[model samples]
Target chain A: MEPFEGKTISWGEHNGVIELSLHRGPCNEIGSETLEELESFAEVLRTSAGNMHTLIIHSVMPAGFCAGADLRELYRRAYQQPRTSGNSIAEVRNFLVRIHAVFNAIDDAPLVTVAAVHGVAFGGGFELALTADLIVADRTARFAFPELRLGLIPGFGGIPRLKRDLGNGIARDMLFTGRSINATKAQTADLVSQVVAEGEALRVAHALASQVGKFDLNAVRAAKKFIKPVPHAELLREIDIFCELFESPAVAAGLRRFVESNSPLPYLP
Target chain B: MRTLAQTTDEILTLAAQQFKVARETLSPNDDFFKTLGIDSLQALSLLTRLENHFHVELPDYELQDVSDFGTLAGRIQARL
Candidate 1:
């Protein structure tokens, strides 16, 4: 498979390991461009699964791995058209469906996957990391689900994936509080497999990928398939619930606050 | 148990070392955002470092309105 270089992301396979890098500036905020590139990457993964043993997803931006979905774009598109009609919600639901398809593809990919995270991985970014079988985080990495502050739950299969990987109580704590947990706490909560020094997540992840790549491909794929089943039904319900909540007046106000705020800590609730 | 002043002093030292600011320059009352010359993401990084240094889980929400080194130390002290 040919290497891909896109505006928001890029991918290339090396030594049977595909390294997909998220590289949008000011942190990779997953907007339409990112989703489109991610969808393409998912397709590539599907086609190249037979040749790949491991997939490593990490960000090249300095601010973090990803700050989550682009709320500014979401707000712009939502209000671009008339709000009197049902078009906004419909459009949002459609986006959710498409994003879910891409996330689900990664979640159930045949090869082992790792998210080498650093800095802020909040909301949709957290969901994206959840797609991986393992998360290797640097000490600077912070994981959060701040969507509740936006009057929305994590629409990108975060709730279901978090529940699948972690305890229900831990999942609820993150969802309900909308707080950011550091790499140490994330490891304690079993969310991160390894916590390396600052700026070392990608290296640690590569080492992990190398280790996994040496194993029998058939056994690795079988173990992944057996242990990691995609929560299709809950993911669908999350989209529905997100769309339902998107129509509320609070989301508009929340998105408006986020988009317009000049505060340095806008990500904070 | 460390007193609040001790905790506050440690926070000042950590913040100074992490941001490479002069240790004496960061006082208890200085707004860390201004004193450290950092933004929110950097602020979160500081929070994580503080949490690790102190071995406590200080939720970001708890520090939403807290911008000074002294108050941050108090929050960490409470957790301790």
Candidate 2:
């Protein structure tokens, strides 16, 4: 794919493996453009799903894998006086639904997927990584869900994913404290499959993908299919609760303060 | 309603059960995470249990720095 100025991903295929790198200058923030590209990419995968054996998600930026959602976009949507696109609030709510669908597409893809992470993967970024079948990170990688500090929850299907992967306690701790977890801690929590040396995440991930490619494609796909799907009902419920909170006074005041302060918001501790 | 000491004893009992240890093995001043070999997630689970038991929602922020049984009891005492 051709790399664009504001684009967040560039993907290529080699030896039945597709490697996609996310890049957005300093921090790869999940913005509208990134989501649009991912939507289109998911469609492409749907049409050519059989051709790929493994999909490796990585980051080209040095600062981090992704710093979660674009705060600017969120602030605008949350605090803007009038509907910017002449759409109703219900229409605005579709954005969350759209994100869930696209990420779900990736999660449900026929090919095995891996996330090669480094630096920081916060909020939605961590959610995206969790969608992968496996995550291999370097020592430099860090993960967190700081949305609670903003009085917003992880609206991009993160709650269900985290709850499924790490159980309710760990998920709630991360959400409530808004603290970052290092690669070692993430591995201990079983969120990361492997922890490599600094700057070796991509290499290790590619090696793992190559090994996975050696397996019988049918067996690999079948194994994935055998795993149960995350409860769709629960995911929808999370989105609903988050949307309700998004419109509450707490979230509104939090977003306004976040924008005004131009710094990380304070939690109780 | 439970007194402060009663609440503390109840919390310690819960903590001991969660860690699968003897009640006497834990002390009021012991750091729950350190003594119990539990992480923050386990601690959070204990917090949830405490909430259900005491019928109070512990403020996540105010308790972020709380580590030991004594401090935990003091926080609960304040709430009471």
Q: Which candidate is the best by TM-score?
A: 1
**A92-182: candidate 2 lDDT, tens digit per residue:** 4787888888888888889899999987787888999988989998866777888887777788888888877786666788888876666
Predictions' DockQ, in order: 0.76, 0.07
- Worst lDDT run of 10 residues, candidate 2 chain B, spans B39-48
lDDT string for model 1 (A212-254, tens) is 8889999998999999999899999999999989989999999
Query: What CAPRI-style quality would you assign to candidate 2?
Result: incorrect
Clashing pairs in 1: none
Off by over 4 Å in 1: A81-86
Off by over 4 Å in 2: A1-6, A84-88, A264-269, B1-80
The global C-alpha lDDT for each of the candidates, from Candidate 1 onward, is 0.91, 0.77
**Candidate 1 CAPRI assessment class:** medium
Estimate the overall C-alpha local distance difference test score of candidate 1: 0.91
